[model samples]
Target: MNFELFIARGILSKDKNNFSRPIVRISIISISLGLAVMILSLAITTGFKDAISQKVIGFGSHIKITSFDLNKSFESSPVDMQQPFYPSLADSTGIRHIQVFATKSGLVKSEDQIQGIVMKGIWSDFDRSFFAKNIVEGDLITIDPEKRTNDILISKRIADKLEFNL
Candidate 1:
């Protein structure tokens, strides 16, 4: 059918003027509003999810290293005890920051509430200051290495669940 003939047979028809009234305008507005809301909601939700993921992935090193022997744990420990001195390990492999860390499983006891958490010991380089922007609590690593600052930086989720003040 030709374009003008098709439209004339429908809305422009003498018997069909009622079909092209306010109802059609309302339906068009409703569909446009629905689409606008859906697109806006999706954009906000995806943006928030991406921002959260970036913060988490940025807080750690790109890669890690372990030993060929003594498969005890992924806990942070002295590099000497953790790995055999391999000469080739000195190569940066394009990573910006390379540090050794150890993890120790422990239960955080705050009054009657107890939370099972892995205490990660890392060099001062990997301390909270490295993730200061994402950190929502107390001051970043200000303590000296000689004094192992038992100061642990917990995630926002954990802090809220445990009712931790900051």
Candidate 2:
């Protein structure tokens, strides 16, 4: 056998009552536990990342196309929906869908309380699955392409703070 292997075998042999046996065993166990903790940490971190990403993406899509204006406000500049690339984006290799959205910064008033909020406007083509899954109390808003609805959906935290309900 090789010199290293021979020496290691001698050191690790069961019949030997050498001091190195306990040291080697402790070192092996510590290394194993450290590796296990690292693996578990990595797994937990990956799971958290995926979950948080899904939640964020649920609120909005992965990629957004907006006007290149230098406005530093919550309101985004308008992009034309009739662009030639809009229709063909779905057929592209990686893109699954595309939708238009608009946001406006406004204030909500109830009794004497007023809270500033950003309102997101969505149309019939917008995805409602995320809101549907996360709606804690009220039902999803029905969007009609022909007629406009005054219904609005707000988060539970905002509802509690503003003392509002469905």
Candidate 3:
């Protein structure tokens, strides 16, 4: 039977003194609960995905430009920091800034903890306003040439894994 006809029958069954009111109440409750669960799942999934992706995008520039040849080897190579145009390509492109990056894959060693990770070294001119906005503790990592220490800013997930308070 069609859905509308089925519903009419259900209503008329009760009106005609059939003993199915309790069953109809249960069906209504089950349908409401199912819809509630589906809505809750969609809301949580959308919110969680948006929050996580925004953090990732904020930590890194929206796009990057590099010589395809230089990036092929996946090794660490420092930029000269003397030239202006190469690093300022993003500025010219109407973007905020262009940051040079070198990636190093290695194991991080602490007194009581160790972890494997890839560190992306950003150039001195790379504006860190994006990171500063998302930092949870300590301080944002500044790329000053004179103060190049071994300290690095890590994500909250890494901090949790390492048992660091940041």
Which predicted model would earn the best TM-score? Answer: 2
On residues 15-116, what C-alpha lDDT tens digit does candidate 2 reach at each position? 888778989989989999999999999999999999999999888788988898889888998888889887788889987667889999999889868888
lDDT of 1 by residue, 58-161 (tens): 76555556546565764544457445544445564754555657778888777668888877677755635457766667767665777866577787777776
lDDT of 3 by residue, 1-166 (tens): 8999997686857456656777777898999999999999999999999988887777665775444454554564454656666645645756765567877777776678898878788767767777778778898765678776677887777788788884
**Stretches of model 2 off by over 4 angstroms after superposition:** 1-7, 14-17
Per-candidate TM equals 0.64, 0.85, 0.66
Q: Enumerate residue pairs that collide in model 3.
A: none
Q: Residue 109's C-alpha lDDT in candidate 3? A: 68
Which has the greatest lDDT? 2
lDDT of 1: 0.68
lDDT of 3 at 77: 49
| For every candidate, C-alpha RMSD to the true structure in Å | 5.1, 2.3, 4.6
